[model samples]
Target: MATAWFPLWLTLKVALLATLGSGVVGILLALLIARSRLWLRDGLDGVIMLPMVLPPTVLGYYLIVVVGRNGMLGRWLYERFGVSLIFTWQGAVLAASIVSLPLIYKAARAAFEEVDPSLENAARLLGSGEAAVFLRVTLPLALRGIGAGLMLSFARAMGEFGATLMIAGNLPGRTQTLSIAIYDAVQAGDDHRAGLLSLLMSAVCITLLFLSGRLLRARHRA
Candidate 1:
């Protein structure tokens, strides 16, 4: 019990950070995709969402090749910065971010797309630049959608397992996050602990979904 607290808290912190980072990137990318006029928008949109549809193991394998110590970018990082992502907490965050990115992107894109283009145009006519209009007129009105996206992304990150396991491995007090911990408990025949962890994970995910739905519904009414 005592040994579990810090690791669980650290896992939550990693998930929170990954969710925020991915939410920001996802929202920005979604906005750009929604505003694009070229046919390339469709292509880019598909590519951005590809991770959501792909197998987690496959994604982890590729990430390993790109960021693992023996991989290209990984080798460079180790040589220069003495940094390595493989089997590290940061690598777990990276895996979570990639896996949860689509949730935020889809929500934010829908929100952005629902906004009237004329509103942006009107803001432009009033001397507001594109960035200003997005920050003020667009994002403010879409807060609820963005909130839903963030919540969902955070939930996804919290539950992420396969990819995180593949890339970060199961190193307790280091890289073993909640999901991995649960797996370890179950596999080691510690059914009692596994049951507790499962209950906790389920409660968290359900709460996030419930709250997100409420926010989305409120936004719809507004």
Candidate 2:
């Protein structure tokens, strides 16, 4: 039924957006970590990677407390700009991004690290600016890894449930992403709907996994 699949559709939409946004942020963070000679690089590296070490549910709860309209950052946003995030699609995306950030960070960091430092140094010696060297030399060599990171991040975001539910709630047309929809169907004893959503999510996740694997293998060949 249309009603049954509505939640599934909403979830997929939110997850897709979250994946893109998170992928971009993660790659940027990875690049910063990779290239940084800053005084606190070690400390900053730990901070960026800390989310992966924390429990996801706890992180989600923290997100709600920070980004929810009634929460600190959320309240500030509302007071300053009349913006709200709690119980919305954007909130779901934020939750998913936070939950899956580790995947992107790890993938991109590894990719960036794999580039030979000498190539970048040579470009710099040849009078290329730092930005120019990164764009023309480092990024090209790391493109395959970046692609793999994107696929991994996308798959992880697609499976995000706890954090997204906590921040976004389970509003059918607004925040009922595929994972939450499946959970709701099971709770309501609607095995049929539950099974369908499960299969759909599974298929999507599998496809992403396959793509990531392929990209990683190709990188190995290169």
Candidate 3:
């Protein structure tokens, strides 16, 4: 029914936005780190990649501490603009983005690292600025890899549950994503709904992964 479909649409919305936001940020970070000679690069990479290996509950706890009502940034935003992310759909998006960021960052970093420095240097010597070389040569070569990362991040965002539930709660039609909806349905003894949502989640994840694999293979070929 319409009620059942709400979670599906909401999940898609959150995943799409999270993937897009993270993709841009991740690629930029990757580029910066790739070109940098700073000693802190490794430390920065470790921090960004931590969420991938860390427990979801642990990440959720950190999110709460950082963005909760009494938390520093959270309190400032609330006092200044009355904007609260806790228990909101925006919070869900933030949770998803944080958890999936590592996948995009790693993949994009590898792609950027693989680009031939000679090519970029040639472009630079030919009157092309750094930005032009990156956009025209480096990005084109790395596009397939970045596409794969985007899909992987999208899948992770769509499947986000624990962190999302902790920050966004399981409010139907508001912050309840597909993964949270499945959990809520099961807890409420709605086995049919839970099963349906599970199948849908599996199908979507499979599709995204399949596309990601295709992109990776294409990158290898090119």
**Judged by lDDT, which candidate is best?**
3
Q: Tell me how many clashing residue pairs each candidate has.
A: 0, 1, 0
Which residue runs does candidate 1 get wrong by more than 4 Å? 207-222
Query: How close is each model in CA RMSD to the real structure?
Result: 2.0, 2.2, 1.9
Model 1 TM-score on a 0 to 1 scale:
0.91
Q: What would the TM-scores of all predictions be?
A: 0.91, 0.88, 0.93
Using lDDT, rank the candidates from best to worst. 3, 1, 2
**In model 2, what lDDT does residue 104 have?**
81
- In the predicted model 2, the residue pairs found to clash are 11-177
For 1-222, candidate 3 gives per-residue lDDT tens digits of 567688989999999999988998899999999989989999999999999999988898899998889889899989999998999999999999999999999999999999999999999999999889989999998888788888889988999988999999989989988889888889999999899988888887887778778777877887
Ranking by TM-score: 3, 1, 2
Q: For candidate 3, which ten residues in a row score worst on lDDT?
A: 211-220
Residue by residue across 35-139, what tens digits does model 2's lDDT show?
788889888778777767877778888997887778899999999998888888888888878777778888888989999999989999999998899899998
**Candidate 2 lDDT trough over 10 residues, lowest sum:** 3-12
**Per-residue alpha-carbon lDDT of candidate 1 for residues 1-222, written as tens digits (9 for 90 to 100):** 665665578678879989988988999899888888977998998988988999999999999999898999999999999999998999999999999999999999998888888998999999998789989899887787788788878988988898999999999889998889999999999998888877777777787778778877877888
Task: Tell me the deviation in Å of residue 152 in model 3.
Answer: 0.4
What overall lDDT goes with each candidate model? 0.88, 0.81, 0.90
- Model 1 Cα shift for residue 61 (angstroms): 0.4
